[model samples]
Target: MANGKSLMTGLLVGGVIGGLATILTAPSSGRDLRTQLKQNKQKLESILIQLKDDSISLKESVVKTAQESAVVLKDVTADLQKSIQTWQEEIEPHKAELQKEISQIEEKIKELEQTLNK
Candidate 1:
Protein backbone atom coordinates (compact mmCIF):
# COMPACT_ATOMS: atom_id res chain seq x y z
CA MET A 1 0.00 0.00 0.00
CA ALA A 2 2.80 2.36 0.80
CA ASN A 3 4.48 1.50 -2.45
CA GLY A 4 1.26 2.13 -4.33
CA LYS A 5 0.89 5.55 -2.69
CA SER A 6 4.47 6.45 -3.50
CA LEU A 7 4.01 5.39 -7.12
CA MET A 8 0.88 7.50 -7.44
CA THR A 9 2.62 10.52 -5.94
CA GLY A 10 5.53 10.11 -8.31
CA LEU A 11 3.22 9.86 -11.31
CA LEU A 12 1.30 12.96 -10.29
CA VAL A 13 4.46 15.01 -9.79
CA GLY A 14 5.97 13.77 -13.01
CA GLY A 15 2.81 14.57 -14.95
CA VAL A 16 2.76 18.15 -13.64
CA ILE A 17 6.45 18.72 -14.44
CA GLY A 18 6.05 17.24 -17.90
CA GLY A 19 3.03 19.39 -18.64
CA LEU A 20 4.80 22.54 -17.52
CA ALA A 21 7.84 21.77 -19.63
CA THR A 22 5.73 21.11 -22.69
CA ILE A 23 3.80 24.33 -22.26
CA LEU A 24 6.93 26.42 -21.74
CA THR A 25 8.76 25.00 -24.73
CA ALA A 26 5.89 25.14 -27.20
CA PRO A 27 6.20 27.94 -29.83
CA SER A 28 2.50 28.63 -30.34
CA SER A 29 0.44 31.79 -30.46
CA GLY A 30 -0.96 33.23 -27.22
CA ARG A 31 -4.48 31.92 -27.90
CA ASP A 32 -3.25 28.44 -28.80
CA LEU A 33 -1.05 28.32 -25.69
CA ARG A 34 -3.95 29.28 -23.49
CA THR A 35 -6.16 26.66 -25.11
CA GLN A 36 -3.54 23.96 -24.65
CA LEU A 37 -3.07 24.88 -21.02
CA LYS A 38 -6.82 24.68 -20.45
CA GLN A 39 -6.97 21.26 -22.02
CA ASN A 40 -4.08 20.07 -19.90
CA LYS A 41 -5.75 21.40 -16.79
CA GLN A 42 -8.97 19.55 -17.60
CA LYS A 43 -7.06 16.34 -18.22
CA LEU A 44 -5.26 16.66 -14.90
CA GLU A 45 -8.55 17.22 -13.11
CA SER A 46 -10.02 14.12 -14.71
CA ILE A 47 -7.01 12.08 -13.63
CA LEU A 48 -7.40 13.32 -10.08
CA ILE A 49 -11.09 12.42 -10.02
CA GLN A 50 -10.39 8.94 -11.29
CA LEU A 51 -7.63 8.44 -8.73
CA LYS A 52 -9.92 9.55 -5.93
CA ASP A 53 -12.64 7.14 -7.01
CA ASP A 54 -10.20 4.26 -7.25
CA SER A 55 -8.75 4.99 -3.80
CA ILE A 56 -12.23 5.04 -2.30
CA SER A 57 -13.09 1.73 -3.90
CA LEU A 58 -9.88 0.20 -2.63
CA LYS A 59 -10.61 1.39 0.90
CA GLU A 60 -14.12 -0.06 0.84
CA SER A 61 -12.87 -3.40 -0.38
CA VAL A 62 -10.16 -3.61 2.30
CA VAL A 63 -12.62 -2.75 5.03
CA LYS A 64 -15.13 -5.32 3.85
CA THR A 65 -12.52 -8.06 3.67
CA ALA A 66 -11.29 -7.28 7.17
CA GLN A 67 -14.79 -7.44 8.56
CA GLU A 68 -15.43 -10.78 6.93
CA SER A 69 -12.18 -12.21 8.27
CA ALA A 70 -13.01 -11.11 11.77
CA VAL A 71 -16.38 -12.83 11.62
CA VAL A 72 -14.85 -16.03 10.35
CA LEU A 73 -12.24 -15.98 13.06
CA LYS A 74 -14.83 -15.52 15.74
CA ASP A 75 -16.90 -18.39 14.42
CA VAL A 76 -13.90 -20.68 14.30
CA THR A 77 -12.96 -19.80 17.85
CA ALA A 78 -16.46 -20.56 19.07
CA ASP A 79 -16.52 -23.86 17.26
CA LEU A 80 -13.20 -24.88 18.76
CA GLN A 81 -14.40 -24.09 22.25
CA LYS A 82 -17.59 -26.09 21.80
CA SER A 83 -15.63 -29.03 20.43
CA ILE A 84 -13.37 -29.00 23.48
CA GLN A 85 -16.33 -28.89 25.79
CA THR A 86 -18.03 -31.79 24.00
CA TRP A 87 -14.85 -33.86 24.10
CA GLN A 88 -14.48 -33.30 27.81
CA GLU A 89 -18.08 -34.31 28.41
CA GLU A 90 -17.66 -37.51 26.39
CA ILE A 91 -14.53 -38.56 28.33
CA GLU A 92 -15.79 -37.82 31.84
CA PRO A 93 -17.65 -41.10 32.45
CA HIS A 94 -14.80 -43.21 31.10
CA LYS A 95 -12.30 -41.34 33.25
CA ALA A 96 -14.32 -42.01 36.40
CA GLU A 97 -14.79 -45.71 35.56
CA LEU A 98 -11.05 -46.17 35.03
CA GLN A 99 -10.29 -44.54 38.34
CA LYS A 100 -12.76 -46.82 40.15
CA GLU A 101 -11.18 -49.92 38.59
CA ILE A 102 -7.70 -48.80 39.65
CA SER A 103 -8.86 -48.35 43.22
CA GLN A 104 -10.42 -51.84 43.29
CA ILE A 105 -7.19 -53.39 42.00
CA GLU A 106 -5.16 -51.61 44.66
CA GLU A 107 -7.46 -52.98 47.40
CA LYS A 108 -7.15 -56.54 46.11
CA ILE A 109 -3.38 -56.22 46.03
CA LYS A 110 -3.34 -55.06 49.66
CA GLU A 111 -5.65 -57.89 50.75
CA LEU A 112 -3.44 -60.52 49.07
CA GLU A 113 -0.33 -59.09 50.71
CA GLN A 114 -1.97 -59.27 54.14
CA THR A 115 -3.00 -62.91 53.66
CA LEU A 116 0.51 -63.80 52.56
CA ASN A 117 1.93 -62.17 55.70
CA LYS A 118 -0.50 -64.14 57.94
Candidate 2:
Protein backbone atom coordinates (compact mmCIF):
# COMPACT_ATOMS: atom_id res chain seq x y z
CA MET A 1 0.00 0.00 0.00
CA ALA A 2 2.81 2.39 0.93
CA ASN A 3 4.63 1.56 -2.28
CA GLY A 4 1.53 2.29 -4.36
CA LYS A 5 1.13 5.70 -2.70
CA SER A 6 4.79 6.57 -3.28
CA LEU A 7 4.57 5.54 -6.90
CA MET A 8 1.47 7.66 -7.42
CA THR A 9 3.14 10.69 -5.79
CA GLY A 10 6.26 10.26 -7.92
CA LEU A 11 4.21 10.03 -11.09
CA LEU A 12 2.22 13.15 -10.21
CA VAL A 13 5.41 15.13 -9.52
CA GLY A 14 6.98 13.95 -12.76
CA GLY A 15 3.86 14.83 -14.74
CA VAL A 16 3.74 18.34 -13.26
CA ILE A 17 7.44 18.94 -13.97
CA GLY A 18 7.15 17.62 -17.49
CA GLY A 19 4.05 19.70 -18.19
CA LEU A 20 5.68 22.89 -16.83
CA ALA A 21 8.85 22.39 -18.91
CA THR A 22 6.78 21.86 -22.03
CA ILE A 23 4.74 24.98 -21.34
CA LEU A 24 7.83 27.10 -20.79
CA THR A 25 9.54 25.97 -23.94
CA ALA A 26 6.55 26.41 -26.22
CA PRO A 27 6.46 29.74 -28.07
CA SER A 28 3.04 31.38 -28.06
CA SER A 29 1.10 34.65 -27.83
CA GLY A 30 0.10 36.09 -24.43
CA ARG A 31 -3.48 34.85 -24.74
CA ASP A 32 -2.39 31.32 -25.60
CA LEU A 33 0.05 31.18 -22.69
CA ARG A 34 -2.64 32.39 -20.28
CA THR A 35 -5.02 29.71 -21.57
CA GLN A 36 -2.42 26.99 -21.08
CA LEU A 37 -1.62 28.24 -17.61
CA LYS A 38 -5.29 28.21 -16.70
CA GLN A 39 -5.58 24.61 -17.93
CA ASN A 40 -2.56 23.63 -15.83
CA LYS A 41 -4.09 25.27 -12.78
CA GLN A 42 -7.31 23.30 -13.25
CA LYS A 43 -5.33 20.08 -13.63
CA LEU A 44 -3.39 20.73 -10.45
CA GLU A 45 -6.60 21.43 -8.55
CA SER A 46 -8.15 18.20 -9.80
CA ILE A 47 -5.06 16.25 -8.72
CA LEU A 48 -5.24 17.83 -5.26
CA ILE A 49 -8.89 16.76 -4.94
CA GLN A 50 -7.99 13.20 -5.84
CA LEU A 51 -5.15 13.17 -3.27
CA LYS A 52 -7.47 14.44 -0.58
CA ASP A 53 -10.02 11.74 -1.35
CA ASP A 54 -7.40 9.04 -1.25
CA SER A 55 -6.09 10.33 2.08
CA ILE A 56 -9.58 10.26 3.60
CA SER A 57 -10.18 6.73 2.37
CA LEU A 58 -6.88 5.52 3.81
CA LYS A 59 -7.66 7.15 7.14
CA GLU A 60 -11.03 5.46 7.31
CA SER A 61 -9.50 2.06 6.56
CA VAL A 62 -6.93 2.45 9.35
CA VAL A 63 -9.62 3.43 11.84
CA LYS A 64 -11.69 0.41 10.91
CA THR A 65 -8.75 -1.96 11.32
CA ALA A 66 -7.88 -0.49 14.71
CA GLN A 67 -11.44 -0.89 15.92
CA GLU A 68 -11.53 -4.52 14.85
CA SER A 69 -8.21 -5.25 16.57
CA ALA A 70 -9.45 -3.66 19.77
CA VAL A 71 -12.51 -5.89 19.80
CA VAL A 72 -10.41 -9.02 19.29
CA LEU A 73 -8.04 -8.05 22.08
CA LYS A 74 -10.94 -7.43 24.44
CA ASP A 75 -12.42 -10.85 23.72
CA VAL A 76 -9.08 -12.59 24.21
CA THR A 77 -8.57 -10.92 27.54
CA ALA A 78 -12.01 -11.98 28.72
CA ASP A 79 -11.40 -15.58 27.66
CA LEU A 80 -8.05 -15.72 29.49
CA GLN A 81 -9.62 -14.38 32.68
CA LYS A 82 -12.37 -16.97 32.47
CA SER A 83 -9.84 -19.77 32.00
CA ILE A 84 -7.95 -18.64 35.09
CA GLN A 85 -11.15 -18.62 37.13
CA THR A 86 -12.06 -22.11 35.93
CA TRP A 87 -8.62 -23.48 36.89
CA GLN A 88 -8.89 -22.01 40.37
CA GLU A 89 -12.32 -23.53 40.81
CA GLU A 90 -11.09 -26.94 39.65
CA ILE A 91 -8.17 -26.88 42.07
CA GLU A 92 -10.40 -26.08 45.04
CA PRO A 93 -11.55 -29.67 45.66
CA HIS A 94 -8.02 -31.15 45.84
CA LYS A 95 -6.49 -28.62 48.24
CA ALA A 96 -7.04 -30.72 51.40
CA GLU A 97 -5.71 -33.90 49.74
CA LEU A 98 -2.56 -32.10 48.60
CA GLN A 99 -1.97 -30.82 52.14
CA LYS A 100 -2.36 -34.32 53.60
CA GLU A 101 0.21 -35.79 51.18
CA ILE A 102 2.73 -33.05 52.00
CA SER A 103 2.26 -33.67 55.76
CA GLN A 104 2.88 -37.43 55.33
CA ILE A 105 6.09 -36.80 53.36
CA GLU A 106 7.37 -34.47 56.07
CA GLU A 107 6.76 -37.09 58.77
CA LYS A 108 8.66 -39.73 56.80
CA ILE A 109 11.62 -37.38 56.35
CA LYS A 110 11.69 -36.65 60.09
CA GLU A 111 11.66 -40.36 60.96
CA LEU A 112 14.53 -41.06 58.58
CA GLU A 113 16.59 -38.26 60.11
CA GLN A 114 16.02 -39.54 63.69
CA THR A 115 17.08 -43.13 62.73
CA LEU A 116 20.26 -41.81 61.09
CA ASN A 117 21.10 -39.79 64.19
CA LYS A 118 20.61 -42.81 66.48
Give per-candidate clash totals.
0, 0
Worst 10 residues of 2 by lDDT: 3-12
Candidate 2 residues 9-106, lDDT tens each?
89788988987897879899889988988898898789878988997998899999999999999999999999999999999879878999999999
Q: Candidate 1: lDDT over CA atoms?
A: 0.95
Off by over 4 Å in 1: 88-118
Tens-digit lDDT track of model 1 for 8-98: 8998999989988998899999999999989989998998899889999999999999999999999999999999999999999999999
Supply the TM-score for candidate 2.
Answer: 0.63
Provide the lDDT at 45 for model 1. 94
TM-score of each: 0.65, 0.63
TM-score for candidate 1? 0.65
Model 2 misplacement above 4 A: 1-35
